[model samples]
Target: MDMWSYFYTCLVSVWLHRLYVYSAVAFGISLWIVIQFTTTRTKRKGKKSHRNPSSPEGTSDKVGNGCAPRQAQEVHVAGVKIFYGSQTGTAKRFAKALAEAVTSLNLPVEVINMGDYDPEDGLAEETSSRNICVFLVATYTEGQPPESAAWFCKWLEEAANDFRVGKSFLQGLRYAVFGLGNSAYVDHYNTAEELFETSSEEEAGGTDSVVDVEDLGNIMGNMKKAKREQELQEGAAGAERREMITPALREALTKQGYKLIGSHSGVKLCRWTKSMLRGRGGCYKHTFYGIESHRCMEATPSLACANKCVFCWRHHTNPVGTEWRWKMDQPELILQEALEKHQNMIRQFKGVSGVKAARLEEALAVKHCALSLVGEPIMYPHINSFVRLLHQHGISTFLVTNAQFPEEIRRLEPVTQLYVSVDASTKESLRRIDRPLFKDFWQRFLDSLKALAEKQQRTVYRLTLVKAWNVDELKAYADLISLGKPDFIEVKGVTYCGESSASSLTMANVPWHGEVVSFVRELARLLPDYGIACEHEHSNCLLLAHSKFQVDGEWRTWIDYGRFQELVREHQRSGGSRTFTAADYTARTPPWALFGARERGFDPLDVRFQRKNKARDISGC
Candidate 1:
C-alpha cells in the first residue's frame, strides 16, 4: 500500500513540475511581447510628435499630459529693396519687372512705393554691404517731386528737421536711380535724379550756388595766360591779353576740340559746315529757312550759361554763371575777330576734295551768324549791339537762347531768326532737364515765352524730342506753344553722341526719322493752324509752320535775305521805330521743299533720284 501511495505522489509531483515549466515559459513569452509592444508604441508616439506641424521644430517635451517650453528661433532676410515714385505707373511696372528678374538669383526683393516708404523705418540704418535700395522715380510738374514722393523730397530738402538722423545719414546708404523725364523741359526733365544727387551734395554742403563774378574774371585771366603760353610754344605768339578763366575749363574746352574766342567766347565748326565743305549740302535750316549753310558762322559771344542742359552736346565743359562776370570784349572787336577766325577756319577746307571753290568763297563772306555754338549767346551784355553789328555788316543773325532771362529777351533787338528752346511742357521737367541756376527759373521761363509772343521778328520754338521722355506730353506741349505763339516749330530728334557726363542719354533715346514724322503728324492733328512744312531725313528734324505762312498753298517760310537786309537798314535809319515783321521779308518756298512733296528737297538732278525714277517708270511700263 505504501509503495502505491508513493508512486501516486511522484506522478502528481511530475505533473506539477511540468505545469510550472509551461506556465513559466508562457509568462516569459507574454512578458517579452508586452515589452516589445510598449517599445514600438513609444517610438511611434515620438515620431508622431516630431512630425506635428503645430510643434514647429518638433521638440515637444510632455510632462504628465502638458507640453513643456521651447527656445526661440532667429529669422534672416536676404535681398534688395526697391522704391518707386510713379506718375503714370511706368516706374511701378519697372520695379515689378526688376523684382521678378532678381527672383532667379535666389534673392528676396521687396518693392515699395515712395508714398508708402519711410527712410526712418530701418532703411536708413541699412549698410550698402548687405542691403541696396533702388529708386525709380519720375519728375512731376514744374521741377517738383510727384505728389506721392513729396514727403520724401521735402524730407531730403530739409535734412536739419530730422534730429535722429545726422547729415551723413545717407552716407551708408547705397542707391541707384533711374529717372523718367523729358529733355524738352530743360529745368525739370530729370529732377528726381538731380534731387537725389543734389540732396547728397546739400548734406555735404556742396549744393551749387552763385559764384562771385571776380572769381570768373580770375578764371578767364588764367585761361588767357595759358593760351598765350601755348601760342608762344607753337611759334604763333601774339599780343598777351589780360584775362582770367578756369584752367580746368580751358583744358576741357581744348580737349573737346573747341577754338577759344577771346576770353569768354568759343567757336565750333558744325557737322553741317563740314558737310557743306564736302558739297553734300547744308543743314535742314538751309532748305527750310533760306540759311546759306556755307556762309553761316557758328559762334557764341559768351561761352558761359545759367543752366546745365542734359542734352547739351558740349558735355557741360563750358563755364556756368548767372551773369557775365568776366571782362567784356566789345561787340565791334568781337565781330572783326569772329569774321577773321571764321575765314581762317574756312581756309582749312579750301584744298579738301568735294569743296566747291565758289562755295568756299561764299563761306568766307560770312553772310550769316548762328549764335548757337555753345552757351547762352544772349547772356552776353553786348548781344543787342552784337546783333546790330551783324546787321550792319549785311550778315543775318540767328540767336538761340535757353529762355531763362525774360528781361533780357524783352529788351533784345530783333534778329533775322530768334529761337527760344521750349524744352519742357511742364515746369517740373524744365527744372530737371535744364538745371537752371535761377531758383525762379520756371517763372522766368514763362515770362520769356510771353516775351517771345510779343516779338515782331521771325520767332521759332525749337523742340528737341527724346524718346520715352518728352514724347508723350503732346497736350502740354501744345499748351506751351499757345503761350509762345511762335511762327514756326522745329521738332528735332535728340542727337545721342556717345555718352555724356551732363546727361544720361543713350542711343535708345534717339528717335528715327519715321518716329519724328509720326510725332509731328500727331501734333499737327491737334494744331490745325500749323502744318507739317518740311523735314530733313538726315538730321531727323521736322518743321511745323502756322497756316498763315501758307499763303494760297505756297509756303512762305523762306526769309527774303535781300528784303530783310533792306528792312534792317530801314529800321536802323528810322531809329528802330519801324520794326520789321516776318511777313514783311517773307519769300516763296520751292515746291520740293514742302514736307509731302515728291522731291522732298532732294535735288531733282541728283543721279540717285534719276535712277529711282527711271526704275519706277520701267516697272510701270
Candidate 2:
C-alpha cells in the first residue's frame, strides 16, 4: 500500500472486506443448520410407525411370544429394541413405560422378553437393521441376572469373547443397558449393570436418550412407590391391606372358577378330577391311596396360611398370619356351599372336550375331600366340625398343614391322612424355604411333629425337595424323620409354577422324575423302618411308608374309605374318647400303584396323556 501509507490503506480495506465475507459465511452456515434441524424435526413429528399414538399402552406393540400374533409395521426411527429381563415384574414395567414413551415419538418399538428372544438368531438382525437395543435387566442375590435374562446375559458375555460369533458379537452394535434394582439392594444390581456396560463399552455412544412415561413420572418417584409396595409386601403395612379375602381377591378367585364359600372357604375343581373324568388317570392320591380322583372335592375351610413357601401353588396370594384373625364361617355353611359349588363346576364340564359323561356323573357325587387346596384348614376355628361335616357327607378327608401350629395339630380330629409339611430339615433351611411368620416356627414345627406322632390316625411328613435347596440334606432329613417318626413320608420334587412374584423358583429347582427316584432311593437307605412304598412318575412324587403300612411284604398304603368313615363316626359318637387306629382302615396297595412298576403309579385302567412343558396342579397337596 502506498509504500507505507498507501500499503496500510490497501491492507486495511482488504482486511475489512475479508472480515465481512467470513462473518456472512458463518451466519449463513448457522442459519442453514437451524432450518435443516427444524425441517427434519417437523417431518419426523408428522411420521408415525403405523401405530395410533393415542392407543393405550401395550395395545399396538409387537411382543415376541411365539403364539401371540405380531404386528407388522415399517416406519420411523431405526427401531427401539427393548429387551427386558424381569424377576419381580419391575424391570418389565420399566420396559413397558419406556416403550410407551418411545411410541409417542412415532418410533417402531418392540418389547421383547430376553427369555423368549434368542440372541443367537436375532441379535445379528438387530445390528444389521440399525436398531438401538435397550436392556432393562434385573439382578438378584449376588449380582445374578433374573432367571428370564440369565441365558441372554450369558450369551452376550460369551459372544463378546467368542471367536465364532463375530457378526453377532457386540463389536459395533449399539446398546444401552439400564439395570433395575430395588432400593433395598443397590450394589447387588449395579454390579450387573457395570458388567453389562463393560461388555459393550466400545459400541455405546456418550449421548443417551431417556423418556418418561406418564404414570412413572421419574426414577425417584417410582422408586418411592416401589419402596412402599415392598413394605406392604413385607407385611409392614398389613393393616392397610384388606381382610384375608378381599372383594378383589374374591372376584379374581371366582373368575378363575373357584367356588368362594361364605367369605372365607373356597373350593376349586382339581385338574386331576378333570383328568380322571376324561379317563386320563387319577392323581397321586388315587395312586398312593384309595381315594377316587373323580369323586374328590378339593377345598379349604380357611383361606389363609402361616408360611410363604417358595413353591406355594396359590403364588402366596392367599392371606398369611401367625394366628387365626379373620371372620370364621360355620362349618356346616362352608361344607354346604363348597359341595354345591364343586358340583356346579363339575356340571359345566358336562360336554367339554375330553369329558366323559359317566365320569362326570360320578364326579357330581363327592366321596373324598382334599382339605389342602390353598390354605391351612387347621387355621379355621371349627375345623374339627368341618372335618365332621365332610365325614357326615361320606367324604373322606385328607388335610395338609404347614406344621406351624402345634396345639392345633393336637386338637385336630382324626383325618383319613394328616400331612405335616416338613419342607426343610434344618432351622435355617426351614426359615429360608417356608418364610413362616412365627418367631418360634422351628419349635412349633417340632412340637407339631410331636403332636402328629400322638395321633391315632395316619400321619405323614411331606418333604418337598427343591433342587440345590433341600436335596443335599440327607442326614438332616433323616434326623427330622427320627424326631417325628411319621407313619408315611411323601417326598416330592418342588413344582415350578412359572414366573411368580411370590417365589424366585425356576425350572432348575424342579428335579427330574429320575432325579427324584435317585433321591428317594438314597434317602430310603438312611431309615431302616421306612420303606419307599410307591412312586408317582408323572407327579415326580415318591412315598415312604412306615413298616406298619407294609404287611407281610405287601404295602397297605391305600385307605379303606368306608372303614375310615365308620371309625370317624364311632369316634364322634363316643365324644372323641374311642378313636380308631390307622391299621383298622388300611387297604391293600395294588400292583400297578406300587413303587418301580411299569405304570409308575398311573391307574392302568385309565388313558395316559403326555403333557409337555406344563406345570403340576399342586406342589405339596
The number of the candidate with the highest TM-score is 2
Q: In candidate 2, how many clashes are counted?
A: 4
Off by over 4 Å in 2: 1-243, 611-621
Q: Give the alpha carbon lDDT tens digit for every residue of 154-240 in model 2.
A: 877776666665533544455667777643343343556666665554222222222111112144456688867875675664554
Q: Estimate each model's TM-score.
A: 0.63, 0.63
Model 1: runs farther than 4 Å from truth? Answer: 1-244, 603-621
Predicted candidate 1 versus true structure: per-residue lDDT over 1-621, tens digit per residue: 999999999998988799888989999999999999999999977876555222333432222211222222111224668888876576789999988965654567889898987765655566444445677777865666676778887777677346555666666454556677644455566777678656755453342321111232234346568976775665455445435347878888878777776788777677777777656656788879878787888999999888877688887777776766567788888888888887888899978877778888878898888999989999998899989999999999889999999899999987999999987788777766777777788898989999999999999999999887788889999988889999999999999877753366799989988899999999999888899998766678889999889998789999998899999999989988888799999998876667877655543322221244355321101
User: In lDDT terms, how accurate is model 1?
Assistant: 0.76
- Model 2 TM-score is 0.63
lDDT of 2: 0.79
Question: What's the CA error at residue 253 for candidate 1, in Å?
Answer: 1.3
